[model samples]
Target chain A: DTAVSQTPKYLVTQMGNDKSIKCEQNLGHDTMYWYKQDSKKFLKIMFSYNNKELIINETVPNRFSPKSPDKAHLNLHINSLELGDSAVYFCASSRFRTSGNEQFFGPGTRLTVL
Target chain B: AQSVAQPEDQVNVAEGNPLTVKCTYSVSGNPYLFWYVQYPNRGLQFLLKYITGDNLVKGSYGFEAEFNKSQTSFHLKKPSALVSDSALYFCAVRAQNTGTASKLTFGTGTRLQVTL
Candidate 1:
């Protein structure tokens, strides 16, 4: 069974448009995260939610918002997609709030804002 | 302020040869280190981790890592690398700033190319 999964594996939209990507985890993990992988293959964390509560909010722009209706799901919404927003988005989950827990990741969503 | 660094951008090895991917970290308190692998067009897969046990930790796919506290390093290693072992490897550390459920700081990543 897939532990973590993301919807719309590929996204193609025009600039200034809005888009939303959904993520779900079946591992019953308490923590979920959103990451952005740039063209340089650098993966950076954007947001993290623990038990549906906002835990970590990185230096990301306000145009990007993450919503976690519950611990099992976290969704990312982009208000105004820009050319720079074209990258691969990854979702991850981990159990417990411990320090050394391993995170499970989902198949990334490739977003292309033309 | 926790961070990890992968000095090597790429490491090439021949099949049946041993391989090593170097990783160093900096953190306030004891670190929680991890190693993840990513194949082309796939998501990151957890390979191994170091919490607070034996310095040497074994992980999936015949991979292991040695946690050196004095050096603040957790390097991934394999006994016999296969061509299929070629992938991008990432090292991450859990930040201890918040004292709560902390966020992970990842390294730049090292690409492993195992040739036949």
Candidate 2:
């Protein structure tokens, strides 16, 4: 079974367009996170949610918002996407109190802005 | 604030040869360090982690890491590397005292090239 999964594996949109990426995890984890990997392969945490509560919010722009409808799901919505938004977005989950506190990541969604 | 640093941008090794990927971290208190590997067109996969216990932690695919508190380093090592082991490796860390909400800070990542 795929522990963590993301939808819309590939998305190509024009500038000023809005898009959303959905993520779900069956690991029964309490925490979910969104990360962005730039062209240079630099990975950075964008947002984190625990039990549907916003926990970690990095210095990301307001144009990007993350919503967690339930503990099992966290979705990212990008408003007025720009060329800079072209990168790979990854979703991850973990049980915070777990011994190792290791996280599992999804396949990732590649976003292209033209 | 916690942070991780992987000094090497790339490390090349031949099959049957041992390999090491260096990682260092800094945190206010103790640190929970992790190592993740990523293949082309794929997401990051958890490899190993150092929470507390033994300084040497063993992980998947014949991989292990040694945690040195004094040096603030957690380096991934493999006795014999395989060509399939070629991929991008990332090191991450999170502060210990920060609640369950603490976010992990990742390194710039090191690309490992294991050739025959």
Candidate 3:
């Protein structure tokens, strides 16, 4: 079974368009995270939610918002996507809020904005 | 602040030979280190992790990492590497002492290339 899964593996949209990437994990984890990989392939943490509490919110644009309805799901909703927002979006989950736990990641969703 | 470092942007190793991708980290206390592999257009895959145990930790794909506190490093190693092993590797660390250290900080990344 796929541990972590995301939909819309590829997305291509124009500027000013809004999109949402869905992420779900079956590992029964409590912490979920979203990472953005830029053109240079520098992956950075965008957001992390633990027990439905927003924990890590790195230096990201206000246009990007992460919504976690529950522990098993964390979805990213971008408002008015721009060219700079184009990148691969990854969703990951860990068993709990402990550094000792290994993270499980989804296949990733590639977003390309024109 | 907890930080991870990948000294080399890339590493080249001959197929059938051993390979090493260096990674160093800094934290306030005992570090929770990890090694993740990323293939083309794929999300990061957990290879191994060093919590608190033996210095040597074995992981998926026949990969192993040695955690050295003195060196502040957790370098990933593999014996008899294959061309398929060529991919981007990342080292991450979490500060065990930090109040909010559950989040992982990843390095820029180190691409490994296996030549025939």
Cα displacement (angstroms), candidate 1, residue A64, comes to 0.5
Model 1 native-contact share: 0.67
**Least accurate stretch of 10 residues (summed lDDT) in model 3 chain B?**
B94-103
Docking class of 2: medium
Instruction: Give a tens-digit lDDT track for model 1, residues B46-73.
Output: 9998888899999999999999999999
Chain B alone: TM-score in each candidate?
Answer: 0.96, 0.97, 0.96
- What DockQ does model 2 achieve? 0.78
Q: Which residue pairs clash in candidate 1?
A: none
For candidate 1, what is the DockQ-based docking class? medium
- For candidate 2, what is the TM-score? 0.98
The positional error of residue B106 in candidate 1, measured at the CA in angstroms, is 0.6
lDDT of 2 by residue, A54-112 (tens): 98898999999999999999999999999999999999999977655888999999999
| Per-residue lDDT of A96 in model 2 | 73
- Give the per-residue lDDT digits (tens) of candidate 3, residues A3-113: 999998999999999999999988889999999988888888899998888989998989999999998899999999899998999999986655488888899999999
lDDT of 1 by residue, A1-114 (tens): 988999999999999999999999999899999999999889999999998999889999999999999999999999989999999999999975556788899999999999
Q: State in Å the error of residue B8, model 2.
A: 0.6
